[model samples]
Target: MDSIYHTLRKSNPASARILVRKVLEKNNGNVSKTARILGISRATVRRARDGELNDLSRRPKNIRKKMDCFLEKLIAEEAKSTGYRYRLLSYYLKNKYSIECHPPC
Candidate 1:
C-alpha cells in the first residue's frame, strides 16, 4: 500500500499544508492524531504546521491565486451572516470553503 506521504507528495504543497491544518483542527490540535492520519511522524506534522518544512510541492501560482479569490468571496459572505465569530468563521472556511486560514480556536 502506498503511504499517505507518498500519496500527498503528488498534491500541491499548499494544499497539503491546508490538509494538515484541517486534520489537526479536526482532531482538536492533536499532533499524534494528525500524524497517524497522514502516516507520518508527529514531529513531521509539527514541523509542517509550524511552517518549518520547506520541501513543499508548490502548485502553479495562478492556481493558488484563483483559490485565494474564491476563498475571499466565501469569507466575505460568511462574515456578513449573523452570529458568526472569527473562530467559527475560520472553521467554516476550512470545512466548507476549503480555505486554510488559522482558526481562532
Candidate 2:
C-alpha cells in the first residue's frame, strides 16, 4: 500500500520482457489484462511482446573504503573491550599509535 517508488536498478530490460511473457501466458495472451494485473503500462507490455527487451549485464557501481587488516582487527578488539567508537576510537588510535585516524575536518 506504499505510494513511494524505489528504483533499485535503473536498467532491467531483459527481466521486464520475461515478466511480460509469463504474465501474458497467465492471462491467456490478453495484453491489457496482463498489464493491469502486473501493475505496468500497456505500452510496456506491448514493447515486451514486440521483443524490445535486451540482455544487458547489470553491475554494481558502488565504491568501498579500504582498511588495513591489522588496524581493523585492533579496532574491533578495542571496540569490543572498551565500546569506544568513531571520534573516541580516533582519539585512542592517535594517542596510542601517534597516527590520526579521523581528522577534525
TM-score of each: 0.44, 0.41
What lDDT is reached at residue 37 by model 2? 74
- Give Cα distance to truth, residue 22, candidate 2, Å: 0.7
- In candidate 2, the residue pairs with backbone N, CA or C atoms under 3 Å apart (3 or more residues apart, or in different chains) clash, namely none
Pairs clashing within candidate 1:
none
The parts of candidate 2 lying over 4 Å away from their true place are 1-11, 55-105
| Per-residue lDDT over 1-105 for candidate 1, one digit per residue giving the tens place of the 0 to 100 score | 766665775775656667788889999999998899888788877877898334745766565434467676767788887457788777877887577787544
The parts of candidate 1 lying over 4 Å away from their true place are 52-105
lDDT of each: 0.74, 0.70
Candidate 2 per-residue C-alpha lDDT over 7-100 given as tens digits, one digit per residue, 9 for 90 to 100:
2113555665777788798889898988777676788678778865675456657546556888889878877887986889789878887866
For model 1, what is the error of residue 55's alpha carbon versus the real structure, in angstroms, after optimal superposition?
A: 4.5
In angstroms, the error of model 2 at 94 is 72
